[model samples]
Target: GNQSGIPYSRGFECFDERFLGKPLVYCGTLGTIPVEVGGRPSERKEIEVGDWVVMCGGRIGKDGIHGATFSSEELRTESPAQAVQIGDPLTQRKLYEFILEARDTGLFRCITDNGAGGISCSFGEMGKYSGGCECELEGAPVKYEGLQPWEVLVSEAQERMTLAVQPEQRAAFEALAKQRDVEVAFMGTFNDSGYFTVKQEGMVVASLDMNFLYEDGCPTLDMPAVWKAPTVEAPVVPETADFSEVILALLSDLNLCSREYKSRMYDGEVKGLSVVKPFVGSQADVPSDATVLRVDYKSDRGAVLAEGINPWYSDIDTYAMTTSVIDEAVRRVIAVGGDLDRIAILDNFCWPDPVESEKTPDGAFKMAQLVRSCKALYDLTTLYKTPAVSGKDSCKNDSTRGGKKISIPPTLLISAVGQMVDVNQAVTMPFKAVDDMIYVIGETKAELGASSYYRWLAEQQGAAEAIGGQVPEVNGEQALSIYRAMNGATRQELLQSATTPTKGGLALALALATVGSGKGAEVDLSAISEGAVTALFSESNSRFLVSVKPDDAAVFESLFAGLPLILIGRVNAGEVLTIHGLATLDRETMRNRFKATLQGV
Candidate 1:
C-alpha cells in the first residue's frame, strides 16, 4: 500500500542462439502518481476553452514515421526503416529536469508525454479534456526541410512533451524555457467548437468532428478464435547423472549462468540510494533475487523490485506458466524483506498472432494458450490481492520467409513492486555466517516439465526433447501464509539470508548461496525428500532456501510452525560444499563453472 513507489529495470536477458527478423528490445519504467500536484488534483484536467496548447522539447523528424501504425501491423519483408525512433539521452535528461521544474512551478495545467503517434495523437487526446482544438501545423519546428504537413503532424520525434497552459503564463513559461535551453512552441489553442481543426499557412488542411474521431472513426473488427489444446511429445526420462556434474552443467548454461559481465555496465547506484544492489555478495558477482532501494534521504522507507519470466513453460501449460511467474515475482520480493500485502504487479505479453488466416492455419491453439494465460492472470492476481496497475501486449511476433515460419514461445514477464517499513531489515541472498542453519521453506514435488534441468539433460543426451514431467502449479493460499511468516521472521531479525529456488532449483540455489558467501555448506536431502533428483532440481513454486543462525533456530521454527519447512543443512567453514553421502565440490571450482559461459561479454 505504498503511495509513492517507483519501478526500474532489475535484470538483463542474455541469448546464445540466433533468431529470425530483428532483435526484440524491451524497456519498462513505472512510477506512482500523486493524488495532487501543485495544489491541484492530478487526475482532473483543467483545460479551458481559451488555454494554449504547447509543444516542448525536441523538433520534428522523419525518422519515426508510422511508429504507431507499424506496431499494430504484422512484420513483413517491406517493413519501413523509418519506424524505429532514435533516442537522445542528453536532451531527454534535460527535458526531464525541466518538466520537474515546470511541475513544481505550476507552469502547466495538464501534461502528457509525446510518444506513440506524436502530435496527432497527443493533441487529439488532450482535445477531449476541452471540447476540441485548433492546431497550426506551420508553427512546428522541424529538423530538416521538405517535410509535408501531414508528416509534421504525425512524426514520432523523441524527447518531447505536450502541455496545456493558460494564456497569461505564456511569457513566464517562455522565459523559463529559454533559461533552461529547451525548445517550446505554441502550436494550437483549446476551443469548444466540437471539432479538431488543423491549418497550415492560414489554409485549412484537415477538420473532423471530435465525436466521430474519438468514437466512430474506426470500424469494428470481428476476429474468429477457436480453442484446441496442442499436443507435444513426452520426453523420455534419462538416467540421473551425478549431482555434482548436473549442478556444474546447469551453472554453465547460457540462461542459468552469471550475467555480471553485462550487468556491471549499467549504473545501479546512480542516485546513491540503492540499499541492496543488483549484485550482492562477498565477490559482488552473484545475482540478487530482488533489489532494495531507499526511497529518499529523508526517510527509512524502502522499495523492492523483482521480475519473473519463463517462456519455455508456455510450451506445456500457459496457465501454469502464468501462475508460476507471478509466484516467482512475489517470492523474490519476500526474499528481500517485502510483504504480500503491499505488492503490486505488471504484465507484458509477447505472443504470435492468433487469427484464423492463411499464414497461420494453426492459430486456434495459440489463441487458446493466450486465453488460458489470461484466465490464470485473473485468478492469481485476485487471490493474491495484488492489483495490476498497467500492462501491454504485442500480438504479431512471428516471422515467415521462404515458406518457413518461426514463432517465439509465448512470453509473459511479470514485474513486482512493493514497499517495506524499514530499509535496515532488508537481507541479501547469501550465507551471513558459518554454522548458520539452512532450511527449505516449501514442499518440492516431481514437477520438472520445461525446467532448466530437463532442458540441460536433453542437450546432454543429444535429444531435441525439451519438455517433460509436470509444469509446476502455484498454491496461492499456502504461498501467502509463508510470505507473511517470512516477513514476521525478517522483522524479528531471525534470518541471516534468503533466496528462492528458481530456474536451476535447489542445487543451483545452494551453489549460488555458497558462491555469494565465499563459504561451503554441509547439506543432507534425506530429511527433505527421498529422491535426489526431485529434491535438487524440481522447479516447484513458492519455495525458498533460507539461512538462520543456530541460536535463533527455536524462535524461527516457532514462527513458521504450520508452514511446509524442514531444516536440512548447516553452513560450514570448509572450502568444499559437502552434500552428505551425495557429492562434494570445491567452492572455487563451482564459482569458475558459473562464470565461464558469459565471462567476456
Candidate 2:
C-alpha cells in the first residue's frame, strides 16, 4: 500500500487548474565525463588493502534517517520526518572544493558521497572493490551527543564524503584538510578480511560475510503479469457554428494552461548563462519548447533540456503512452534547434502496486501495464537512437484509507538533454514577424484516444470516465526523418518559430502562436482531407507547427521534400485569428483565458 498521500491525493483530485495544486517535481543534474582527470584515469574504486577509510566534511546527525527504507515502504500518516535532510550549502561547497583539490593531488583512490543510508551504503558499496572493510563507528564525527552506534552507521547526514586514502599519503591528506579547514576522521581501513566488520571503541559491534552482504543477501522478485486490452465507446465531437468556446476552454485546461505563476518564481538565468530561456515571446510569457543554457561562458557551447508526460494515455494503452512521451521529449529538443545526434533521455516511472494480494486483486493487470510501458520505452529509445542513460522507478503508489482506494494512472516522464555546438541557432516557440508563412510539418490523423480534446468534451457531455478513441501511435522512422529535417532547417536559419501541437492539438497550438506574438493567423484547412475538426484538434504525433519567411519557404519546402509538409496559413498584423469557415477568436481573449486559470496558483 502507498503510505504517501501525494499520488493518492493527486489521483482523486478533479482535473481543474483552479482547484488542483502543483504536481510533484523531480530535479536532477546532467554532467559529462572527461577522458581523464588530472593525469589519472577516472575509473575510481581501486581501493588497495591497508588503505585508510576516511570520512570527510559534515558531522553526522539524525536528519535523513531511514530515507531509503522509508521510500521503499508504504507512506502513512506517521511516517518518520527524520527521512528529510536539511542541507548546509556552505559546508557542501567547501567539501566540493576540497575534494577537487584532493582528486587532482591523487590523495584518494576511491570516493563516494554520503547520500541515502549514509556511510552504511556508500562505505559498504565501496568496500566491495576491496576484499573487505573494518570501520569503527565511534570515530565518526557527530553534530549532537547520545546518538546510538546504529544511528551513526545509517544516518544520511548531508554534505559528507567517504574516501579511501593510501596509508602512506594519510599524513599529506590530513595536512591538506587542516590547511583547507575541512573536517576529516580516520574511521578504519580496507582489508582482505572477507567480512564487513564494524566496532564501537575497542569492542566489535557488527560483522557480516562480504559474499552474503554484497551478493546473495536478497532473493529475486518474481511476479505474474497478464495483459488485457481495454475497450470503450468512442467520443463524438459535436458540430458547432463556432469553436471559440472550445478553444477558450482548452486554453484554460489544467494540462495546457499557462503556469507562469509557478515557473516565474525560479531564476533560469542564474549565473547569467541562460540563452533560450524557459519562456519566450514579445511579452516573454509564452512557454518555450525547451530551455537552452550556455555552460561555457567563453564560447556559445550550451545544452538543451525538455520533458514530456501524459498519464491519461495509459488509460487507452501504456505502450502508446510511453512512446508518445519519448517522442514528445525528443521532438521538443529538436524544436529548440538541439542536436539530435547528441540527445539522450532519462525515464521516471511511477506505478501502482503490482504484487498480488487481497487488497490488490488486479495486480497482474497492473504488472502487465508496467511490462508494456518498459517494452515501449526500450523500443522507442532504440528506434530514435536517443538512448536512456539513467532512470528511476517508484512502485506501490496506490493509496488506501477509509475503505477508499485510489491508484494513480501509470505515469512515465521522459526528460531529454542534448549538447549544442552553438546557442545562436536555437529557436523559440513564438511568431517572429507578420506575413510569415505558417505550415503543418506532419500528417494529422484521427487518433484522439485519451487526448485533451476528449477529456474536455467528456466533461461537457457529463461522461468524464468514458474514454474511447484510437490512442496516438508514433512511427519512429517517420518521426526521425521529420526531426532531422527540422534540425536541417533550424541550422540553416530558415524557421522563424517552431513548436509542437500537443494535448489540445493544432488548434491550441495556433491559438498559442497568435497569443505569443499578439498577432493574428489566417489559416486554411482545405489541404487536410480529414475535415476541419480532425485537422484542428486531432492529437497526432511527430508533427510541428512552424513559421517561415517567404524567402526561405522554397528552401525549407525543399528540405522537407516528400514529408507531410503543408502551407496552411500566414501570420497577419491583426489581433484576431481566423480559420476559414470555422471560427475567429481574439488573440488577447485567448491569452487572458490561458493565463487566468493559473494566475495565482
TM-score of 2: 0.92
lDDT of model 1, residue 223:
69
lDDT per residue for candidate 2 within 290-380, as digits (tens), equals 8888866787988888888888898889999999999998998999899889999999887777787888899899999999999999898
What's each prediction's TM-score? 0.95, 0.92
Off by over 4 Å in 1: 1-9, 14-22, 32-35
Query: Tens digit of lDDT per residue, candidate 1, span 540-599?
Result: 999999999999999999998999999989998878888876668788898999998998
